[model samples]
Target: MPLPHRVSDLSAFDLLLSVAELGSIGAAARAHAITQPTASARLSGLERGLGIALLDRTARGSRLTRDGALVADWARTAVGAAAALDVGITSLRRTRESRVPVAASLTVAEYLLPHWLAALRPSAEGASVALTTGNSDDVAAAVLAGEARLGFVEGPDVPAGLTAATVGRDTLTVIVRPGHRWARRRSGITADELAATALVSRERGSGTRRALERALRRGTDRPLEEPLLELSSTTAIKAAVAEGVGPAVLSSLAVAAELAAGTLIRVPVVALDLTRELRVVHPAGQALTGTPRTLAAIARRSASLDDPAG
Candidate 1:
């Protein structure tokens, strides 16, 4: 059925609800950010259009009449339903845009991407994201192959044929279980001592592993020792460390909760730089536009919220 011609104005209904809530036309006008005179004129027009007295006005204030109270109750539901319909339309538009394909390294995929996506929704951006998770190299490959339109990674360098914007930084922390020997050390361990030891590690291509190797190489000419155990996922590595598997160097992003809860101990490493850039990457010549661009800006702005200092 068609909406009634007499009550077709949704804004007027919204204003009516506001007046009902605030108890005065002037207060409602302030809430809606309009002039009191404009508010009074609009409400008057509404009553005239509906052929009913919706307000009982006196010198002190305006209050809803008996008929006005009933109309206000119905208007509340109408306004709520209209708002829900608008949200549904925005969601449909997002679907029609097709989820913006994103490739992200495990750290970003697990820890940061959801927050970025959350920031997008309330703004009515009419876009959505479909995420693919992997190591930094895998993320780069996905973007280059057209499998993803945008990619996020943390590492010493952006891969060839891609350009990156630094959105944040990740500090690789050397962590061990609370009972481990390094946990009680009064002095920081040297890079040589770290490189010579076998510890649990991320698989070779992971940004976490690469950042550690790059930092260790600066202080030694010898190749780094093999991992005691190699894990593909950050969560698994954290679990292994907490179980006293061995020491592992991981992104601060990955081990924050464990450190906070005393489940893991952060062993200081002297004279080593374990910090790496967290970046958003795309094809070399292609500039980000639309949703991806906006998301990247949000990432840059929100960078400092969770990261541990280097």
Candidate 2:
């Protein structure tokens, strides 16, 4: 089947995106090592092809008009799709390739994976890694659907169709506003008290929720306080907790800065290991013992995941 346009034609799409981001055609052109005339002509050609005016070329510089911003959005999407396709094709040509496709739950993906990927040099694996971020369940789905070769889940048990290994550990700390009553109560706070008070929480399928469930199950049958607000990201949960909304149980990694700066205070929660082991899960049919093995080893080696509760 014929593609909508040749891949090279998307250079104009990329030019539009770069100009939007850089906020000037000359600056964007220089970023791509192209002359001003070439950039201007490229933008004009793209606008002509798409049958719309995409930019307001100014004497000082260029800026996106109303239509330009909309075109910029589509062009950005096209550029990303083009890049993904390019990487996929390049990996195919490699004899012993390591196109380390991964889908990881939010915490691991947002806070940790980039560091791990940077630590992995092209010398050893001679492979490339591409990451997709999602919640625990979505990460599992991506792996099961063959969209990712490996999955890292932070929330719950590994979903079926994938075998998992304990690669690392994360600490879930109890935290509240710096001036909260729990601030004086160091790491051994009781679940009875935790249950009595309102706390911010993640949605049902969060890995944090799974760990919290296990912790609560072992404690007194007292109905713990329901969530004051259910949020998705650790950032949101911590922000709410800091605002005196409620105390929350969250990854120490999530609140390290706040704890250090006194934006939030770490309250002592005892007897329960709020720590969860992070695992690398992959499909049963695919022999994933290759890149994940190397990637996991690198992750473990450089990981600075030593939480006090862990």
Candidate 3:
């Protein structure tokens, strides 16, 4: 089977999708590093080629017409497939070279690292990546032991032997099922209440667990109690919480979709700050160079884009 000639122009599809997302052809041009005239010409060319009016141009901005909206939806699918192909090709190239080995904590690996990797891929030249997933402790150990060129961790305290640069921020949220008692509480849970409750939790070495323990220990002498169930993975904890096993603390990134869907309700923790810095780590005294440096830059850029204030 052969594809249509118009479908072969992936860059045009990507540009169209970007325009749809950004809401203006000029904005999309700037984002794609092209001049407004160039974007306008390209879009006009695409419209003429397809024999359809794609955009309703206005003085304020441009918007997709009904037909354009349908085409943009299809363009989004094509762009996503192209991105997957790009990543796959990069991974294959990595296997043949001395790829930069990266170790990252589970939250970061699952939610943020993929975007960073994608941002780095096109400009990476011949560079490739090998990623390892672990807890904060494991990531730090991998970087310090020289097993990984770079590492990402979610904990507040950086390990002794690693130099860390704050790359992003993740807020740990307290969540419970719809029917849980905490979900119906009018007042936020106090620090003491959170500490004493035997809820589902991560393992001891996890960054999420560490952040919770630190918050619980503040302004009180009460020792943290053991969790009702200690799980090593965030997925397991989320599942348990949704099943009404117990309320659990998890990264906001991990539970965003569930929260939006109303499957998980956020229970505010009064007098406790659960926010944690996400950091990129490398062995102390080792200057970041080559692929690691590029990766760090991409991570920071990705973080800035996610930050509303940035």
How well does each candidate superpose onto the true structure, as a TM-score?
0.67, 0.65, 0.66
- lDDT of candidate 2? 0.80
**Clashing residue pairs, candidate 2?**
155-207, 186-268, 187-268, 187-269
Q: How well is each residue in 9-97 modelled by candidate 2, as lDDT tens digits? A: 87888888889889899999999999989999988887887788888877887889899898777668778988999998877766345
Over the stretch 110-197, how does candidate 3's per-residue lDDT look in tens digits? 9888998888887777777889999999999898888899899988789788899998777888989999988998687888888888
Score candidate 3 by TM-score against the native: 0.66
Instruction: Please report the candidate that would top lDDT against the real structure.
Output: 1
lDDT of 1 by residue, 178-207 (tens): 999999995979888899989999997888
Pairs clashing in candidate 1? none
Model 1: runs farther than 4 Å from truth? 1-96, 305-310
lDDT of each: 0.87, 0.80, 0.86
Model 3 lDDT on a 0 to 1 scale: 0.86
* Candidate 2: clashing residue pairs, number: 4
Query: Which 10-residue window of candidate 2 scores lowest in summed lDDT?
Result: 1-10
